[model samples]
Target: MNHGHDLNRRDFLKISSLFLAGSAAISSQVGQALSSTNTAFAKDDREEVVHSFCEHCFWRCGIAAHVRNGKIYKITGSEHHPLSNGKLCPRGTGGIGQIYDPDRLAHPIIRERKGGKSSLRKASWDEAITYTAEKLYQIKEKYGPEAIAMLHHGYGYTFFKEMFKAFGVNKFAKPSYDFCCGPRLQGYTMTYGHGTGTPEGIDMMNSKYLLFFGTHYGENMHNTAVQEISEGIRRGLKIVVFDPRFSTLAGKAEKWLPIKPGTDIAMMQALMNVLISEELYDKKFVAENTVGFDELWAEIQHMTPEKAATITDIPADEIREIARTFASYAPAAAVHPGRRTQWYADGTQRVRAIAILNALTGNYKMPGGVVKYEKFKLPKPEAHPHPHFKKDVWSKYPFFVQTKPENSITSHEVVQQTLEKEVRAWFVYGVNVPETITLGRKTAIEAMQKLDFMVAVDTLPMEVTGYADIVLPECTYLERYDDLDGGRPYRTPFVSLRQPVVEPMFDSKPGNEIARMMAEKLELHGVFEDSVETYLDKRLNKVGSSLEEVKKTGVLVGEPTNLYRKPGEKLTFKTPSGKIELASAQLKSAGFDAVPKYIKHPEPPQGYYRILTGRKPMLTFGRTANNRFLNELPTARENEIWVNPRIAQKHALSHGEYVHLKNQAGIVSEFPIKVKVTERIREDSVYMVHGYGHYYKKLKWAYKKGASHNQLISKADIDQSTGAVGFQNNFVTFIKEA
Candidate 1:
């Protein structure tokens, strides 16, 4: 019951402030305290600490791996790292679970078909690498390098990316782009000419009022964001949340508006109308720093609160009042452009509306408003020359992020192309393909089954690995050296390191080593250094830091960058017009709406409710689905479908009953999910955590734990402009347990 040295809420708050102080002594004290209490460490065992970043999620918070007798016994937040400061999420401490998971892929495996029956057989690293490279070359020789595509999710994919590029195979994709960050990134790029980087650019700690549209910060638990939000709450910052379900974030809000799903743009337009009509908008800021104001006004002039109230289901007076309060906060208030925004087909426009709202309130770069965080200016090392990519753009979408040379297509496009046989080979790295949202689980599996050659590089034997022709066992983050993480943007810009805390277990190898082996087998000359450590040292040397220096604290910090704009400063944006685009010229040129428009999405069919999916605070979908340490908590054990009282009664579902969900396409769930009948959800929608209901037998802890959200997504609405897949259109009906 003690749960070791548990930090109470008050104690956590006290230490949370110390994170900003960047005190090494405080970090040491904290780390020692946690390590001393860990029963797994023996008093006689020699102990050492190694600094690295977490791989549980993309936020990549720094971690301190406490090693006893050459084995990591505990993990704690690194104080020297800017992102985590000294605090870590549940997932960070759960790295040990991943590293020691019994289900982990321990060696290289190749699927052999004998007498039309296929089975995986363990193979030596050289045999596996050689076979994989040969097949990839054959695919390239027959179909072209473009025919070989990769779907990657983790930081480990960097080496493979370079390897693929050296081989002239440029088609790459990340599933996160299709279902998560893509819409918001493209939306902000279209309006502000840049994407909102991780930790987001919100100055929450200094803000008076924060407006959120279904952004569950508490549940999502991005380290810096959560820390700042908690600090902001202590400073008496007011919050307003718009979500159909009363999310953990909504529970902390001064106002929680249960806005109708798929009508966010309408509500945003209504707020703009009120701000413009009531003359509450920052007129001077809009006139001086932004273009297409007239065009934006014209589009939203008739979108009054009264009209939006009917569409969004929030009272007209309430909408106006919220808008007025938001405006009254002036440069301190901002409407947060929420993450995982690919809900409706108009997702990009939805975020654009958020951008326009924030701009109208004159909160572009204010201390308590929206600001652009800077990244550590780590210079890149020279790269080996390779053949130019045959194609610059593979996505059919017009406005995919093109600020940099994008050799990849969208993940959904990859699925479509694979089904079409245009993509003959696939390299899946650290992503569970079937669970990762693309067109759907069925379509993803179909595409994988149709592939001529498929190689999966992962730590665990996830479902995707079963479909692979070759499986390369990748060591867990605690046992790997990845490329330096300098891309994360923050107030005090810092570059974090990911170094091995222990030797890799079993026959599994680090991603860098695997990539180098593959590159060598393919005869790709000079693509990689003699060793991963050498490669990292060379890159770190460019920034006047070495691997040895960074290994001490796991991060190299830079001076804090100015995040706010000066008063009366001339503003220039990266947009074609050189100003904040209230109406995007590029979108218009691409034959799309210049300004965001609220298009009506299809309503749920009779006898069915829309399925809303989110994450549990302790788990991040697939990454933590099989993590035993994190899953030990009561809340993390399994996911349940949250049904409203009205819907539960209509379906004769009790609070503790179990039911299977059938989608609109009549695809029933494989496992029955526990029903949580509560008022937290709307009668028209049911809520469930994603990344559950694993059917893979190898995932012992996660198998048949809950219903899979991805499996129910039989319908997909692709955003034409950005190629992001919108899946909120799918509806589900309950089927009582047999």
Candidate 2:
């Protein structure tokens, strides 16, 4: 090679810069052109379009796809959508990558042997289903249906349970409760005695104050409420954020209280102490609309500000100021209820304290604040009975999830205990377990090992399928029929259709069709198994709409509607006492302290830090971990340890330092992260992202992105009463490695 072929460093640099600028300009133009292309699939530039929803992050926002042929160009949130408001966060806009993922599982596979971690053998659907049903029969014959446990998470529970019932396994639990959104139900139930309404869109557009207890509404925006919150902030709403980390929401808030982790109860109680002591509470509203003010006041009086402030590490004066600010805002001030409650051991109680604040302020069911969650009533699919299992095995606990669905213990605890052979098989669908569950590297193999058989049904051969004995390819949300809960109705209510943009790549089928097919094969086929046409007709006709109608319009308007707040209307709290409970009667009856108290949790050793990790608003755990488009958006294991700089400096720590996080579980992993050491974090605590650190080498990009947070955690410290692991109660201490 000629020496001159290697251009001088300066000349090479100049040429490279020119090339980069040209590429960037070209890319920008492509993005602009792509936006205008109605049919992205056109070979001659035909604007091919497909109507679908973005499943990238599980908010499942509906979208009309632009596809010309087989190639998917780009995606945008359904602006016409009331829920999505024609807007999408970064992930939703980048949803096209999922449609054409090169790594997408393209065929049915059967794990031949029971042991050896069930590698994919590449089987045809005929062979796969035949083997699966046969094993289902064998498992039933050998171990009874109750011996089987189904851990199903994600949406579309209705269509996936056919096999669980057909196989006669009643131990069906969705990881949603364990992995997320479970704590909301628990707190709501404990307070209101009923499952809560869906995540109510905080009417941020009209609110004057927003208190965030680790609530990242803007970061996780999808539902209309998130949009409302953004609008409110734009209009200068006083935002107060309380978290251990200086989160994106916290950065935006007018005030950020870096409270100690796992002691939110103390902070909330301290705020209550302020509200009561200052007499900022709405006495008139409490007297007219509530029932147990005297008792609640008396109980909180015992939780003095000094005690709560001491535990939460929030200055008592600041606590008082926050309380007064919140109380003064009246119905215009609201505390945001975040999704994904399955965090610490005290997760439910923490949420309960926050929800009760609404009641205390007489903000219950009001405008721009604690408003009711209104969902458009859609026609139900035909009520198909889960055919009586050949045998019915029920949980002795008579599981009580405080809120709707996702009681953590009711799902994984059931699965793990049953797999230790307490349960024989698992028929699961609508989720990818290995990704959704914590400590997935271990759980994925262990869960599959103890079962007599395992079947997973999903749109892709997700990580969970690697361990599945039988894999059923299910369609994406766009190619399936399902129920939707959080979208605009007066914006218009209509059944949205997810027609196939392309053929079912391989043996893939929609859950509805899969359920029907399984029903027919299992000998349970009858009125329910007749045909998709008949079932849709039977079910949809009741709601004054039909499948065919939805297919045609993509959605149906709920009609002229009005859900409003009548000013000066009496507020009604949804508790047994019909008032906010400073001292929960349910807590008292459960043989626990009535007041929300901060109890000391198990402490980690001096050398290790207690790592509290959580879901990224950009990517739901492991869901978008594989989508390069979404993964490249932001926060791919930028292992940020939210520590007090005071603590970091003492340990000779610096930002961007690489340190090993070693836990008692013997998990030793190193991360080179930007130490977000700031005053916003507790001196003793740290936090990072979960769902990184993929053990599967095949996951190419996701492997070792960050430490496996679950590895550092010992699930041994579960809340006995609820059986959910107290993720917060387990503690650790930080040590700086030289």
Candidate 3:
């Protein structure tokens, strides 16, 4: 808001260029090291290569693990696989680290009591399973089947979700949707008639323009999308980014707008206004392929660039110019839907605005825009209906309930219910809620303490494990087999295999085996009745392939098809109107605005700044926060708060000086972190990479190393349509150390 800030902006651009070059050099060296084949162990020593999918962070890249004398030696990208294309990101490169980490939970353990001082003792798998089954039955008989709830993640989550349902448990808290990508998926599904599958279907190869709003592909390290965007850049694709901080991708962008946080909708609305006012939209495409265009135009007529400039803090001239550039590019340009759509209460409508922009430019199913790929069908076991429960998504968060058939419960809504003692038991599998969820660590601990019973299943001993009544040690991805990843949005949708490169260490068991064991104990049939390999074989049969062929090739391929929709193909949508709902009658009927309108986000109080968090290339958000190889990378070792130089001076804080942070709720980070005084971030905000400040004492490499952004925020503003927990609305100020 001040002219003096312009000087800081110019300085930031120059400084960021140098920072990126240094970072790139470091990344290249690390990548080369990881990809290099470790030939110290001779191939003749009972060595072999196994094809599997990397579960390091859920990109599901095909990986080849080399085993020597019954031990994994190295991991590399599968050369023939479609997703990786003989390349693996930094996180994927550390696959061996995850599998061989010394701190992994190697045996089942049970806590005698609740609270922090409760002692844990090692137990056999039989004892653990029997205890869990008996307790589950007892709780079900007393409190009803709805008393059991689950919070889980990882590739095997599908089976566990069904297992709970088969056991007649109706409550669940799977957080992937509410915490990460629910709003984005819901918005796209409402507008385009289908959800944009992960590793999005964007055809970046032929695109002329790439528009990003707080989404940085390079930083996120989505393997295929990074490759496509790099190729697009080489072919002269113009990149525009709108973010509060100068992120890794922002350094490479042709145009970077330092947008005010929580104001993306205002900027998008202004773009639509300019396109509609100057007749820059595709008239032919609109008339034939879309519905509700007239209503959208009428609503946007009052939202001029000048009005938007006041809310977004971006120049009016720049807004008009960006709109023109996008229109001229026609269907080749796209507004990329971001993955982390949990920023504000109005997140769903914000994504709807971007969908409207795409519709106006006729980008759906275009060569360089959004495309829909065919999904590989798998056979599901027959399910019997269970009694509906009162405390469910349909009762509490009906507006956000997904229309498409899905079984997992809305996570945030369940967490809220946990506080009120609505559930009696909880099962946590392969997720770290203490470090990753919104609110704060203290709140999570309180909720866990209140549960009648809690069980955790993971390879690593995490904070959640410390609170569990029983802890089941699950084998790592490399030590066991998992379900196939039905490939990406590419023309040829390939299915990749996950086979064990080595046997499970200690007494750990594969997730599927654990699920099957429980199913047998509960007398639940059909699902999990067969071995994981047998199920995979049956599923592959649907696509005219077999487990044998998949193991040989690592991936089974389908025939390629055109990326764009044919001209004569009938345009259809799954919405109420059977067309693109640009004006969104669904929203209007739900007691919400039909069109996205600018709402002023709360500003930080005097002497405080908004806390903003994002991903780093080497760190994958709490999953690998303790990975030794990744932690060794300079950028991923520990997080430093990025503060503007002027703000640093104002607080008498020099670079590398340690300080603690306190939020509006008086919640403080336990550890102190060093300051990074730079001009690459806005003065009103301080930036930190997520996935640090591990409180689990056993995670030696990550414990008390850096400040956790999650711990500093205590507010929860859930999105109306998705129940996404919004933490970006939190404000904090630094506390100087003695």
Candidate 4:
């Protein structure tokens, strides 16, 4: 309930409603048990229920598509599925808009150069595939197979990756790491020796004390986490959050520390200083399970709470109190490893601090701490041959590990380097790389422009599609039979299926079919299954279930078992020293800092503020930004700049006044946006929801309607440990209309 600065009378009123609403919701929704299971597939005469997994967001909640008169009328989360637990967030509920979107590409398109201008022309699937295959082969012959680089996203991209690998090429790109949770993944693996399988491995429901830094559960809309956190709150769970903005998680916290940006490491260091100096850490667990504790203790000698307070801009007393509260709860307390660690240049070390804090608390393998994800193993495709190629940009970072052995390069780095002709061909699937990657939309467009050939596979006409030489139309998830969605670790392990509720619309084909067709054309058919259905059946049969049972039940739940290490076991780690490294010997050996340390980020230049971006519940980055039902929501459509009232008054800006934004690098926004001058944000920072300011003319609902944070970001600072982009480093000044 604390404000960093005084709010103007009008600004106070505007934010009062937000604060009140958040307060009321927190009081009511927190600690409420999850809803009772209700099968969305009850026998109904008017509608038929078809089971599938939602592609709305990466959460992949199980969905029951309601087919009425051969068209999908509604989507409901499957009650039987553990992830969904009979509920869907706003994005999942608005999935119908995506399927029936008017802006959807109806058929394959070929961008033809006429009068030195590119124009899209409709082409037959046969003609499109033939042309695409011919161009890829030509690129392979002329510049070698290594010249072909692919950027893909999600489980559905398996075919695209395999097909390229079958072509003896292994260069791949995904923004998931460099732009998202690469730091958390690397830090967790180094500390725990293996990545927390998909969906994350936090046991929030059992935790009594939860410490969150920069992650928003309700707004992020990870169904299981939201449900669990709400239920935990009802159980009288204590929560603490550190963020500049009053996020949903912050509003619910017992204490909300508006810590200065890029000072998370200082706060973490102070927490460790208290635990180690006070001898409050679990001594038995530390002695039996960890390595390099002496080194860690020695490193923390200078990291006093007062010292951290100076750097973090938080009170030393509160820092001490929080650290005490965290250790008081012991094994049941957890420091939630945040998902988006692509903040400052030292983000990897920041997450490493989080990992170490969890380790010091002896939280792993305990009821309320970090738990292992139990996964159901499925059949892996026959290993495809891949030729050794030039390392992609991700390989430069010491901490960046190959998520898979075949591909280790950073796609964004490659995209940026493509301007210098490092890569010749690009196969973009499922992701909008140009918008998601750092260094702005212009850099992405220029890289695409420089490519020898570009093929975009998508269901909509996005900005990337505008620059592609060929556009392959894909059917929406509702109209496709993708592989099984289940088999990952979760509260309960389960397998969900994605089946077509209706036939493919227009001339668009399923992603698997597109992959198969490409493979057949390239005479690499052995790399793919005969059909997507066959692939699903093979995976389902491993668990004594088939495609038919999944269609009937919506999901197949696995029996619960103890997946975590037991009460008494020899503890081991995968690090170079072979134990949980309190002070990483590997990092020290690699010449990086052996322990987490505060690294100050550059302050904003005069007359500019740091631009901070985050998610909105209705929008999932760029994918659902154009969803009609979702985008029509006021919060989803409006990309207002959240400027502090003091800053606004100084700049002669008023509420609702539209202004252009120019970043420190001299890149200006493509459009003017409304401003919300309030005390919700810090004076030194401006906040905006990402995934706006669309330039694609065909997306009438989203084009030029709001400001794009990406356009204002022209510079990218690479994290030395992870090769991930420190996306929040840029600063921008507002430009009022004349």
lDDT of 3 by residue, 1-738 (tens): 111112110110111111111334434433443344654322335768887888877688888888765567788888878788889998888877776676777678876644524557778888898899988989989988877788877786666766777777766565767757778777777777777776776778778987899997788888988988899999988889999998888988999999999999989989999998999998877887677787787777888999989888899999999999999997999988878877878888888888888889988888788777765444544453343533345325545655543534676555666778777788888878777657556566667767788888888777777677788888888867776777445656777888877666567789889988887787776656467878888888876788888887578766664667887787788888888788778777877777777688899988989998888888886578778888888888889999999999999999999898888777777888889999889999999887788766677679888888877768878776566677888887888997
CA-lDDT, candidates in order: 0.84, 0.60, 0.76, 0.77
Clashes within 3 Å, all models in order:
0, 41, 0, 4
C-alpha lDDT (0 to 100) for residue 161 of candidate 1? 88
Write one digit per residue (lDDT tens) for candidate 1, span 1-738.
111112221110111111111235323433453455445333236788889999988899999989875457789999999889888988888888887776666668887777756766778999999999999999898988989999999888989988888888878898898878888888998888888889888899989899999898888888889899889889988999999999999999999999999999999999999999999999999998799998999999999999999999999999999999999997988888888898978989998999999999999889789899898998876665466745477888987764673335898889889889999999999889888855778778777767889998988777787678888988888878999999878899999899987666667789998998999999997999999889889889888989989989999999997988887788778888888899998899889999999999898999999999888778987778988888889988889999999888888889988898898888888888899989998888989998998877667789889888888888899899998899999999988877
lDDT of each residue in 82-106, candidate 2, tens digit only: 5565677766766655544444454
Candidate 4 lDDT tens digits, 1-738: 111112221111111111111223422321221121323322233578787788877789888788764567789888877888889999998988877776677678776666655556678888899999999999998988878888877667877887887887777877777867687778888877866665778777778998999897778788878888888888878999998877888888999988888889888988999999999999999898888788887877788999988988889999999999999997889998887877867877888889899999998888888888776555554556654533353366777882543346676777866878978999988777657767667667667767878888988777677667888888888878776765577767777777777665567799889988988888885777777777777777877778777888668887774746676877777776677878887888888888887888889899899988888878886678778888778778868999999999999999999999988877778788899988878888899988888766667678887788887876788887778887788998988877
Residue pairs of candidate 4 with colliding backbone atoms = 31-233, 31-234, 394-410, 486-495
Candidate 3 weakest ten by summed lDDT: 7-16
**What TM value does model 1 have?**
0.94
In model 1, which runs have C-alpha deviations exceeding 4 angstroms? Answer: 1-44, 405-407
Deviation (Å) of 547 in candidate 3: 1.5
Off by over 4 Å in 4: 1-46, 114-117, 386-394, 402-407, 561-565
Off by over 4 Å in 2: 1-45, 114-119, 193-196, 386-399, 402-409, 430-435, 438-447, 459-462, 483-495, 527-538, 559-587, 633-654, 670-680, 730-738
